[model samples]
Target: MASSNSLLSEMQFLCPICLDVFTRPVSTPCGHNFCMSCITCYWNDTPVCQCPICKETFEKRPDLKVNTFISELASQFMSLQVTDAHIWSADQQKASCGGAVLCDICTNTKQEAVKSCLECQTSYCDVHLEPHHRATGLKRHTLVDPLASLENMICKEHTRLLMLFCKNDQVLLCDVCAISRHVNHDVISMQQAYKEMKALLGDTEAKVQQMIQERLQKVQAMNESVKQSVTETKDVIANGVQDLTTLVSEIQKSQKELVKVMEEKQKEAEEQADEFISGMKQEITELQKTMMKLRELKQTEDQLCFLQSFPNSSLLPHTMDLSTFSFNRHAEIQHIRKSLSKSVSELKMLLNKMNTEIQKFSDDTDVSNNTMLRYMQQFEVDIVLDPDTAHPLLTLSDDGKQVKYSMGSGLWGIQNLNPNMFTEHLAVLGQRGFSSCRFYFEVFVGGKTEWCLGVATASVQRRGALVRGPGCGLWAIWFLEDKFETFSSPNVPVHFGKPERIGVFVDYNGGQIYFYDRQTATLIYCFTECFFTEELYPYFNPCDNEYGSNLDPLIIVPVSRME
Candidate 1:
């Protein structure tokens, strides 16, 4: 049985046309056997009937019959091949299970290849791979995993394994190519190049992660800003609604009072007309009674009786003087209407004038406070107060940007007084003076009850009892008793809300000084048509301490540029 199995393994059981174990063996008249379907298809495609092995032609197509003996032999050979494959390693059995590389040596049955020999450029199943492990010459052959294509792993030019990389050419190289053509082309081992590429990839990944985190933080910040903006918008809408509702209510109340006054005037005119009518009717009744008595006297035919009963010819019955009495109901009502109409016309004119100013203010409100302030900040100057020009009762900050009233009056030691010192006024001037061009600065006035701010001419008097006004060469505004006043010729009152910060802008060529509420961006006051003949300096006054009521320092805040 063993010798028979060996002979069967050596026997060629594969059909020449299909190159596989025959499904049904057939014998032609020429005595050659092939797969039944394969020979039939081959004969149908040819012009003449012939034997594939002997090249013998036949006049007529020969009838074919299945060779049962040969079919049985092919089936036995297939069974034997599978039994031999099962004896191989378990890994080879699994590899040959499905979709595995077929061994080139197996003739009757398909067997999965376990390894590929690079030297022979051929794949071997475990059954055929035994020679490589046992034979001395075959053991030196390089083997790798089963590969379908080996051309890609070899350098096409040198026909050798690609073991090196040419950095300059960005291509694979073999040892022979590296020494002959790529010697000076930055050649490096494939392993070395892989390490460098992996390190670079790791660094790139880190940078990408950092960029992602930064973007996420920016998105979070932007979302928060949007939320804050939404909150502020809602607050503004609520305040506007409340203020408008109050104004409308007051207007309605005034209209009701106007209606009540007109109604009262109408009621008075009606009452006076009723009194006049009553008097006239009483007079008519008395006249009618006198007429009836005269008729009775006439019927008696007694002239004496009639003449005695009649009212005296010289003395008529007492009655109202109708000729002199005149009640013009319409005239009184008309006079009231005319008076009200004149007043209403004047009121409308005043209301329209007020509306014009309100519209202007509303237009200015369209620009946000930050926007307007940022615009003005472009012209901001670095102002430092001059110690020589500061008042004795005022304490200056080390940075020369703040000042406040000294709490202890006698704490200041007597020192050499300069001509620029303020002897009476608790004021200070900036160190830098502007003779031309425009300048702007901001001051924090919060927590202070009284303070003064403006620009003054350098030639102004710094002596005792300094007169504060333009006529005295000093232009300034001061807050006292909760009232804002500009120190002009006669001291004009300014109507404005309490401001926490004040921004002062001066147009030297235009000769104007403008004050603005920094928080609201609302215009506080403006001094126009001024003639400046000398250099101007920033002015500040903390006023009196008033037992700590006005002790908060006036800070010259730093300004930053905004885009």
Candidate 2:
């Protein structure tokens, strides 16, 4: 029966190519072995090389990496000296005799010392050794037994037998080795080669394991850096978005002013054209009527006899009066002409001023906001500017009343546009607060609703509102369909009572408007966050336009029959 070591030796240690031992060996995908450089040289010469085991053609040679650990293990196993198990057992029983010398032939175990000679196959006490040496001067008597003698044998070029042990040769070579091919090369006996290689095995294994462990740690560190880079990419995109929003606000403001200037100037120009055209039309109509009457008098029967009697002198005077015509222009027309000219000149001047103002706003579009809220961005939001250690973000207000019309905290929520489309929100930062608490706002877009997250947020102020401020929380509304409740309080910003003010407008955009606590800039729970602004009824519009009376958010929910 083959031992496990012998089976493993055949499986992993032996290289199929060469077969003597694995030397600089490498394994293929088909589990066949070849020397590293041997395979590369083979494939480089041959365009496609087929694997020996599977006959699978490989288009390219893989990288040549050393399998040094397994190769070293193979070399160590080939050099050991050992014995047959059954012979060792029999020898052990014979060696038990007292005063008998143990054979130095096979095993490393102990027995009584005996003077043993292998050629005679005789074991003798040290006193009996003198008789055999004097007889015939025997030449073939090996002093040592078979086990130790096996190490001394060498190969000869002529006989090629295990004989002629070479003292200078280091390796067991065939009889051909001592020919001219090895004329000057130094060599030693087979015993010397085995001794040297066996001693180096322990040190080789330690070095291989240390190298593999170090490389694996390097691969792991590289993967962690890849994950960190993904986080940084997200931060850059979020900052870009905030910058775009600010730019859009400035653009809308400049556009509104431009439209106002153009409309005023256009109206004045049209008025001037209409007044000049109307007076010219009246004079042209009167001249046509006078020419028609003169034709009637010349053709009439009553005037025909008088025309014949008057002769050439009367006809000349009539024709003369017809050719010459004039009128005194009223001061009203003159005054209108002067007034219209002045109006146009003023309109042109206003247009020039507007163009300059627009350029100023456009140039400031890239204004940078360094004051950012630092925090890890949640799923809904994109950018988080949270520092390692900063005070908890204050989203709440003290007394939780940031919506007190124009009275409390000096916060007057004014619309920048007609519908307040372009508006800014301010928040009174709250104190140390729980993470779950959030802000609420009521919107009135045709009806009452809420603002979306991130779309509505606190003002730029980071400090908690201990003193009177913009009250920290501001929800700008168009109040187009609805209106703002008009009322004021001295220090308290929020209207504590029922929503009763001049205009009651709800923020309605399907969004969340966070009215933070002014004291610490932290969001208040249920006290100040309002969702439905329609609760403040009897709403009055803020704009002074005649159509302001039509302030009613048109809300309609048409229902279908349920199946």
lDDT leader: 1
How accurate locally, in lDDT, is each candidate?
0.80, 0.39
Give the residue spans of candidate 1 off by over 4 A: 1-372, 407-416, 489-491, 546-548, 560-563
The positional error of residue 475 in candidate 1, measured at the CA in angstroms, is 1.3
TM-score of each: 0.34, 0.23
Model 1 per-residue lDDT tens digits across residues 136-253 = 9999888888866666677677667777999899888888999999877899998998998799899999999998987886688679869997998899779978977887797788
- Candidate 2 overall lDDT versus native: 0.39
Which lDDT tens digits does candidate 2 get at residues 3-44? 788767656665555555667777777667777766666676
For candidate 2, report its TM-score. Answer: 0.23
Could you give the C-alpha RMSD of every candidate to the true structure, in order shown? 30.2, 28.6
What is the lDDT for 207 in model 2?
Answer: 72
Winning candidate number (TM-score): 1
Q: Where's the lowest-lDDT run of ten residues in candidate 1?
A: 407-416
